[model samples]
Target chain A: MTAANGNVRLAARSLAPAVLVMGKGGVGKTTVAAALATLEAETHGLAVLVEFGDGESGRRALGPTHKGVEHVVIHAAEAIQRGATPLFGSATMAKLALGNFAMRPLLKAAPAIRELAMLESVRQIVEARPGVRVVVDMPATGHAVAWLRTAKQGREFLGSGPMFELCDRVARELVAPGRASIIVVTLPERLVLEETLELCESIALDPGLEVARIVVNRVPLPLAQECLVDARALAQGGGALAQPAAALVSLLEARAAASAGAVAALEVFAHGPHAIWQVPLAPVDPSARDVARWLRAEGAA
Target chain B: MKDPRVIVCAGGGGVGKTTTSAALSVALAARGYRTLIVTIDPARRLAGAMGVPITDVVTPVPLPAARGRLWALMPDPRRSMGTFLDFLFADEPEAKARMLTNNLYLGLADAAAGVHELVAMNLVARAATEGDFDVVVIDTAPSRHAIDFVTYPARLAALLGGRTVAWLAGLAQRSGGATATAPRGLLSWGTGHVEHLLARVTGPNLVRDTANLFADLALVRERFVALTRRASELLLGERVAYALVAAPTAAARDDVLFLAARLEKLGRRPRAIVLNRADTQAAPWVRALREGHGVAPSITEVLDVLEQERRTRATAADALAVELRSKLSWAAVVRLPYVEASAPEDIVAALSTELDAHLTALLPDAR
Candidate 1:
């Protein structure tokens, strides 16, 4: 591993039990999820980062597709279908054709198919190896809420069916205190924060689920108080900096207010049950790996 | 395809799909087409943007300034289902009344995972074909994938296959309604794997009632099939156009790409991609203030950081735009500036004027 990888390993030593990163669209959930997964891999020996879609995003992260919905649904459907199949003397395997028919329709008709598939896939990943954890980069807020709600909903809707058993199992994995937790990632803007709060409020509503952490990403770095005080004093002298100072102060004020709004949201979030972390605005856009490295350094700091 | 009868904006949540629909409606209305924009955004930003309150029923938006007529509605799916049931059994009043008043039917309809999509499809199809509005714009739910969850072509037809409906209706007519006699165990309350599971879960009483409701639905299955067929045609027809609205981020563009791909498989692709809230690069005056006529040494340090950050953001935005173009097949990509307008009216008004010239030149007359 490179020095950057080594640094992440050190930081990963104390990650929370499980992490699920979610936010509104374009709120950097993928980068945050990737970062957390990298840090998780450090302590856990191996970590799986799962995306719920076509597995293209997963391919970008870990090369080959690490069992997501597309792969899991078929396996799950076959398993469930086999449950309905009788022991011996089955006719032409035609009874099982219904199973294949039911796969996409079941997954599509009920949110349960996708939900159970995703949850089971994560469980399989962690269980496949010793000391491994899984991080699910959940979809945006609206569907994320639906995805999270499906386990219990499936149990309620599909009682006694093979699908119900899986839902119950998934719910148990999610509910056990330290077994799983969700981390909400959001920007420092007002609208985004409002949406984040709405997400947190829903997370709080789920009975057994825990809000692990909230990362407020892409915040402007605060200027040094002394530097600002000196600048204020020097602006009175009116040199080459006067006009820029006037311009800078207003811009600085907006930046400061945005940061303040983020801090203020944290204060509100603190009333709820999650720990919060802030990621400073980067000079350049950072990828998932870069975010992981930065998070490690941030954790160290 | 400027004057297409329908424009549907699909994307992930909070990517300004509703705003894009509102703006497109405004522009089309300005171009002298009577327009209606339907939004399913629970946030209901459309009404706020139009300076009106959206209802389950369609309401004409107060467009004192815009030239053409405009209306908006948020379909309450259950109510739409009720109305649709009426239409389905229009010939058989007794059957329609019996189904409408049935508690089991109401429960099934209310709990329907498929009804919402069906209702949305019905509304858009009607807005295009039945309603007097010259143009209909749809702002759908922010589904997670490119193939959105809330709406898909012939979705109900696929999920509720004709054979499955026919079989259920046949059984229900024999056993559920007790109109015909049959030997037990075919679709008996206790037999058939699907019915067994349903009876086990919902209890025999509810299952029996639901089976009876299906018998009634069977009486109207032909109409339902015809309706879905109409919905499918309205969607894939030449008059409809799809557009993708995305923020200038990897995730949103990723959704646009996925949506474009999915639409392509259906032979229906997005006509335009709107990149919302794009950062405006520095102006000549601002550039001069930073480089040419610099003042205030105290502010110089912070100013330098701010300028550097702005440049970085601008570069990133441009790169993302280029990346989307390279990845996706759609070409009519437009960027809306990240202006500071909060209210819905201001956003709609600003977007209308801002998009007028560009949209006019880009969009073509419908064939």
Candidate 2:
């Protein structure tokens, strides 16, 4: 794990084939991943960004495609339909339609098995579509663990089988350094930081993947020391609410310190080269254009 | 089975079951019925929705409505397992030890996905059969696992019986004994390990005297049958109404349909569908302001778009309502406006109003 700057430099130069953007749900992983792919496409003129997941959140976030950047949204269910063909080739397309009549009961019988089948189907896509930057908006933490563990499950259940062999190989390739990079997006909050660090540790254990950097979204802007002092004095030198002014200042200072502590904790836990970028919460929902501008200005992507 | 004393809500993960359960329990309790909401998801979502800090212990919390008292508890399978072991062994140390040491027993208990449901069901059964709450509403795991949860004990018992039935029957034939002996070698060793574990956990006399606990298949079969039937009745009874919850998205609507069909197969009928974030036509004035931007070709086109939006909402709501009514003897449609905030108060209040008319008849005093 290089320093955050070094890793970013490495990523910019090498531009790994597969990048998995992962985080706890609702932490702006989708936004950041889309921005990264869009920026890479615009700046260096990449051909396309293949977004994989149930939500197709990246495709939604990135908006319509442009000349340099074409977005291919691969829904897992659709991918499952495609992948099941080679295995269940004799079956009709209707039989393989993800939630169709024939497949529904079998899929429901064992959920873990269904998930494994879907993931392998995904791996098949990754195998076919080479030489492109594919960004997987991986499921949130718990399900991400489940996704990674699918190979282990396959090995256990179908030892020496082709499905098991392929899953194991794909799992090996994914966890390998330089093959894939994992970006852990999180808010600069204590619990989120802890989970992010735990995730990093799990990735570290894999030996194939690297914790690229931590993008801390929705951070509050800093107040200058002089500005705060002036505000304190003005409040103290005031009207009917003057008496409680000192207490209010103390509360505000505590909150400010807590926010600072969150960032510091992330820096400490993120031992590898890690960039801590923050996005100020806009009063109104930020437009995709505005979000892109902020990303570039903040040097997040 | 009309107006059965308990309602078990079952569904898959990430669905709005917890929210539905909390809102329903709050609604029922507000109507002056004592209600308990049970859940298992460790997200502490139910607690957060109910405005309680994360705690495993069950405690009553006052809802904002009049005469309302809703208690919430998450299913702790490990603790439930302990209580179940204690109950099975009659609090005897030897019996507890045998169960603990037995490979098959421990494997079935720990390795099985549906065992959590079994233990939780036991707790639910005890509450419904013993506790005083008029209704025990379960916000089940998502529909994917809901069926398994309700049928687990029966399914597991049947599976085990199938595996051992022939051998047990042969042993009964040979020995002229109603209580068939444990099969020899690996099977006997496994059973002995279980017996020893039970003896150590529950006490030696428990193992010696209660050999029939495992040998007599009838006891296990009887409990499973009773639990399955009771749960099925409570879940599917005419009075027990399942509210299919989904946000207003095409994907969600599809999932709700799939979930409703699955639940119906399991004998749990969905009496209503709540479109959680259903979009209503923006005020005509607001639409007029947008249309007046000089971007539109004609008045007809503007009216057509607005008409389309309104018609879509009407059709979606109507479709869901009709589907539910067709499947269930009683059904209604409830639509809630999409709110930007994810606050509990907003969700609770929104759902409460939608449920107002449907829940009126089911209030405790009505019974």
Candidate 3:
């Protein structure tokens, strides 16, 4: 690690880096978060990755997360059951609890009980290990907003339940500077990039939450400037079998245009110069190692 | 399309799920099935595809090309929940108003994650019987949340379990007697007497009016349960067909496999898997411009790079398709090329063509 890396690395340890990796459903959030965790674990000692939903994506990503890294998956339904156990008095209460939640007849009640339960679970994990790096792999854009909204509502609605206390703690930690950073991942497709920028704008509404850089994933690996010029010169030389050269420049240019538009939007939405990172479009699926290395390289750049 | 009773297009977000939902509805309607396609959080682009505004009210889209009627709408959860309340408290007018106005009941039916699904399924159940629609196509929220719509009945049933209803009814009964217990014409009692009377009958804080809600909704709990069960039965039962729509990415492919496994665990399975945007031809213009014409080196270089990218993407896509087929042994995985259209309708029209085989397989004789 470079001296600059050492400085930031030390800062991260002091601050207890907690990042919420967010994106649309198809965007590679798990891939990016796991890769970042793997890097932190290699650089620092303690890092815990948390997934909010029930899916195995987080656990699967954790397998390659370097040693000493912890993986904690919070299945919302199960968490709610844990919370409902006292009320249900037994497993049979699971159904009634789920129904009441669905109907949301109670304040701070709704299927969002899962989000509430998940928030409480995250707070415990963060509080228990003060200096531990917490990486939360959040759900997609739409559902993610719902989770954030729940944090705000839980504070207002639940007068004095254990839920209100957890929500207050989480809401504070999530917005605290250097304590939590939200990283948004996006594919370079026109629509996906635009949607991501919109998400960044919406997340900005939360005065307490701090959004990090936008990670534009799966950008086709770009060639050096001189190499592209040479390719363009060769293509302009009219000849047989010159089609490949022309297509390369056009394809690369198209990708550059898409990225530029998204970046421009990101800058405008962020209200200042925003940090934007790009990941090379993978030839095949990338492993955790590939992503970690790529992140390091991007960081250096 | 087999029975054309119910069709749910489900997958993670950004996988073209919303587009797939619209196209399937268009195709099903064209094939002579009276269809209602309900999308949640429909983007403006998609709402524009139907050539009409898809709002809270169910509006029929005039599909000039389709043989049967086509209708579309985004479920209004508040309204649907109200309808549900009306059905539940149809017998007791005053009680219905109280429950509707109650903070807890209103809140539950309003934004509970399952509220949409509950409202949607309620809509679907209604459409299945009295609405006279041959097919009710559901386009759900992506990810595991999509499954929330399918399993919502259970959660809702538990919410209104027999005991919860009994408790509410019993409260209402006691409260009714308390109203009478106001010492035979309350003009004689002072204001303190009235306050005492209310305190005695209303049960303490939190549980106050708890009985009234039960009393009002007591009659419809069984019917509500019946409605929810029937909707879920339509979804998981033999009458429904499931299609998993996914973009051709390794991550999305992995999710498709997981979703299939999840469904299988529930004793259900996707009728077919729709692998959308499968064509690795990331840039279509390059292929069309370069084939036989001898282009300049600059153009050729660009073409070559584009071709290489395409080939690489195609290879990755083929591998994912192979993995999907191998793992989902029972499902027929259909691949759709990268749809080039930007306008919502054009994309839907293009996807409908790509999904022709699977749709045909579902209906067989419709076309």
Candidate 4:
């Protein structure tokens, strides 16, 4: 790659055992998570792609999983049941309580139940599958924050119960350095970048949960200044190409200006150990293999 | 054609729903209608786009050029439950005091996604009633389950209005915070067994707190019911309009379809589908350059790449529009060109102008 490409080489050790891919909606969190899972599974022994909520995006992006990679969709209700089965001391009793109609609304309305359950489910998977990298496709920005903080909230709420112990275990795992890290994905747009910076600040407030990397997706390729000058000159020469040339110049100029602003913002925000990577704009949606190939070509492994 | 007093912009994240909501509100205000834009997203995007500081309180937006006035209510998610409680318990100070101090309630306030959504809807209801706005635009959260918040009002009302809550409240009253002992009542046979199982799973402390919280809430159940009823009416009313925002990407298309299906299942159809950034503005220009004699060889490679990218984007967008049109024939599908502005305000202003032209089609009676 040319020096102009500016792709950072991420060491393999930098990849945490648990990588939570998060960002604003529509910023390709699923794509990044899937790609990361594919890369990890191929490089390492096995990797699990974990998806929250509906969980279809991760599977769709990953497509048919190759050997050594697994996909699992986690729903709150099922997670809660799994968590309760151990707590209640019997599977049948857990089912009875959860199945009770009177308990349904109460459980649904209870605060942090979904978040705690999801974390508990993840904790179980990590505990059960040793030496497996877990890549989570987290929810959008706002809810994802809540999900990350659920362990703390659960401990405070439950105080001294079996559930509180579960929360403690999950919280410890999350705060363990080099064990869990966050990969924030964002676009190069002005507003998206601002939101991403704010999200990073919020995440930093939680100690031990590191912002390992920031991947700026869909950054347009920089156009040569001389080419733009030539286009402007061509536009000034009034002809059929004038309007088209002017439009092209304006479009390219606007895009370049926007990209420059994003670059400047990232420069100001760049600090500490977390690296910021930029993925150039692609013509179509990238598959997991494509992303893995791109990262490998960049020497990110 | 009837004019909608409420417009709800719903879609997945990063589809420009907040920007579209702000622009639509600006356009509505420009057309001489007093408008209030309420954003449920905690991301502060609307505030950034409008260049105004928005909080839980309704703040007037200084749209000096518009014929009518504009206001915004962007509730802080952290403080939404508190604000909502203050509103719900405006008259019942004792109940509010009790519930605020309750550990369960405190936990709920911190981690309850449902509370934030309900609080946002409640704030919108309060704004519409108290502000005397001609139209209110709601910018929903960026999630497939964003539409699920529409059911929160009814679901909460039902939960609070149910006999179970009354029984729980009665149990708390009899037991006086001691949930370990069973209180004898008509519903004891069924509830006693369920309570035992619940306590086994969630612990006695949680059960006690739940009972205490319900008892405090029982004092203001009537007000909660009334507030939720009003919010539900405003959301599910005939004059409410649903606008689904989408981009050209396959992810955005799926989000739009999913949201549309969710809305349809709720018996509310989308009134308009906003295809944001669905067109390449320079496509025609690039086509002309390719078709005509491009005498400049220096920029030939750049032009070729631009033309190919434009064709790819155009083809994808065209296919998306066709599929959406066929799937949702009832909703008016409006395409918004990609605004070539970097600043958030500039983008909003440009899209507002575009939306102004298509407002009538989107909102049939928008004059």
Which candidate number would show the highest DockQ if scored against the true structure? 4
lDDT of 1 by residue, A1-301 (tens): 5565564454343344456778876667777887677656544446767666565554454434322212122244443344233321242232433443322343354344444566666655545644566677777675666666666765665556444666677677763456676778887766567767877887778634556667888777876555466555545657765554444444455567778888787666553322566777775546666676667665544
Can you write out model 1's per-residue Cα lDDT over B1-367, one digit (the tens) per residue?
2333767778876577777778877887777777878875535456666765645566777776556488777775436677677778889888888887765555344334445555556766656555577777777667644333335424544545534444445544544546645435334442354443433333334344555565566677677777766656655678777778887655666677778887887778677777776656653324645574434454456556656766676676677678777776565777775433334566677677667765642355631
What is the TM-score of each predicted model, taking all chains together?
A: 0.73, 0.56, 0.75, 0.88
Model-by-model DockQ, in order: 0.16, 0.05, 0.18, 0.51
Winner on lDDT between 1 and 4 is 4
lDDT of 4 by residue, B1-367 (tens): 2233888889987678888889888888888888888888747678987766758788877655444488889888877777778877899888888887888777666556556777777777767777888888888888888868657656766777676686666555544543455557546566666665665555656666788787667677787777766666777788888999998886888899999999889899998899887764665666687676755665777877766776677777788889999999998888876665556776777778888888876566777
Which docking band does candidate 4 fall into? Answer: medium
Candidate order by decreasing DockQ: 4, 3, 1, 2
- Better-scoring candidate (lDDT), 2 or 4: 4
How far residue B138's Cα lies from its native spot in candidate 3, in Å, is 3.1
What's the count of clashing pairs in each model shown?
10, 35, 37, 0
Model 2 chain B: ten consecutive residues of lowest lDDT: B201-210
Of 1 and 4, the candidate ahead on DockQ is 4
Q: Residue A184 deviation, candidate 3, in Å?
A: 3.1
Candidate 4 chain B — worst ten consecutive residues by lDDT sum? B171-180
> What interface RMSD does every candidate have?
5.9, 16.6, 8.0, 3.0
Q: How far is candidate 3 from the true structure (C-alpha RMSD, Å)?
A: 7.6
C-alpha RMSD for every candidate: 6.6, 12.2, 7.6, 3.9
